[model samples]
Target: MEKRNQSAITEFLLLGFGDLHNFKILVFTLFLIVHIMALTANVLVIVLVGVTRSLHSPMYFFLSQLSLSELLFTSDIVPNMLWLILVGGGRVSVARCIAQFHILCIPSAAQCLLLAAMSFDRHIAICRPLHYATMMTVTRQLQVVTSCWLLGVILALFLYTFLRKLQFCDLNTIDHFYCDVAPLLQLSCSSTCTVELAVAMVTYPLLLSPFIFIIVTYICIIRTILKIPSSTGRHKAFSTCSSHLIIVCTYYGTLTFIYLFPPTDNSIELHKGLSVLYTLVTPLFNPLIYSLRNQEIRAAIFNYIQSFKKWKAEK
Candidate 1:
């Protein structure tokens, strides 16, 4: 019976901001621009970090990895969102929905680990500057980044193992944009106790542990900064990690609200709004925040522009 029911529903109708009938075109245009800008900005960051010898440190390496993850994250969701806006919601096959969820989860999980690693890097750079070089060597940087990606893949697969077992019956409408865990579970007819439990087990630790780790790491960083004899030194040290701290707060804040609090029937719209913040707006802002705030990134961009101009003149 469950098998038959699951087989009956081949597709789900994602009700993505369908209520914004008056603003659909406006919203679509905005999202399209955001998507393009996010892709361009992240790509630019990755390219600069890759090509610029000055950005070859562990911090910049992690930044490039972050750009890669954001690039993938936005690519996975924003285009679908644009389509939804244009068509006023869209039909997605069950398989496609599942794939979307996994793709989304992989970056999300990787980002969590990556942020923690970044915080640890800052901690070492600030708190133990003398050993920073030996500690965060090129080989160790690769190991840490590889671990983040590998663990992300493992975690997503673990969730997929349980999610694939869920059976959806007659209902095929997902309230929010894309195939999120909460909405999919709500749509399923099967007893989702195990699935819900699995999600909680995975989500709480994945989110909280890293969050706690980052908090503790930042505390140490702050202490180190405070101890700096000169105000300039303190400001310089703080500047090094401020962009990352902002990204961490924004990313975790929105994610916590969406996942930990799971939306009530009345709050689905609010949920979608917060989802947009993290999914669309956050990625768009990340590269901008880093580039605008960090002197090194600005210098890299300026140098590249000069090089381009000289090349064109020679040609």
Candidate 2:
């Protein structure tokens, strides 16, 4: 039987943009450019936040780590994606696919928790300013960050164990650009009801829980901002929170669209597009949003640029 032969399959072919034969070169070039920009921007944020002492608050600290998560998240998939496009086809061993999936899940889950933690930081900073120093101390920041990563890893491993038990048949073509859960599940020979249930159970905690936490934190922050007597004070408070809000919306919106919707043949393309939005576009835009919209980040970047120029002139 066909099911018996499934065990011999060693790899899966990733049909990454293969349908765009006419625009193959164009697609490859565009993705390559954006991937480079995303990497540069995230790395810059990480370095600037670490070296710039003036930017050393719990808020910036979370932003830096978020950027780091984004960097690792994109790196887990993008390089392989770009290479596939260059070669005009992509082949990934089962082991490599599983590794990519695990690596991808870890960062994705961490970012969700990290975003929630950032929202909490903002809430404490604005809603409870008197207690901010005691509540969000350096030790507390470390604990929050550690918890984010540890929770992410634990959830990822938990889901991964269940996923490995599913039987993958001879169908080796993944319709997406990366080795993602939906596409991988589609290739399985076994009944996917249990896998889907496991996925939902795992994802709900990582996705919805953080999303709700963010909404609650932001609501509290907005209320606190509105309570300020002066219009100028309210504006200042809202401005501080706006950049993060934009990122949270974009990241979670596209992600929720992909995860919440069941993937069908008609909707696979849409899923890929939405995946690109969060995985690539969001990371690319995070640095731009923070740098251009936040006065402090802009100042730090300008000062760093000036120092670089001065060093070059002295050389």
Query: Each candidate: what lDDT?
Result: 0.91, 0.86
Residue 220 lDDT in model 1?
90
Instruction: Please write out the lDDT profile of model 1 over residues 1-315, one tens digit for every residue.
Output: 133344568899998888677888888888888889999999999999999999999998999999899998988998888888888888999888988999999999999999999999999999998999999999999999999999999989988989988878888998878899988888788878888888888899999999999999999999889999999998899899999999999999999999999899899889989999889999989899999999999999999999999999999
lDDT of 2 by residue, 109-192 (tens): 999999999999999999899999999999999999999899889988987887777677678898877888887787777777
**Candidate 1 — worst ten consecutive residues by lDDT sum?**
1-10
| Alpha carbon lDDT at 98, candidate 1 | 85
Superposing every Cα of model 1 onto the true structure, what RMSD results?
1.9
Give me the candidate number with maximum lDDT.
1
Query: Candidate 2 — worst ten consecutive residues by lDDT sum?
Result: 1-10
* Highest TM-score model number: 1
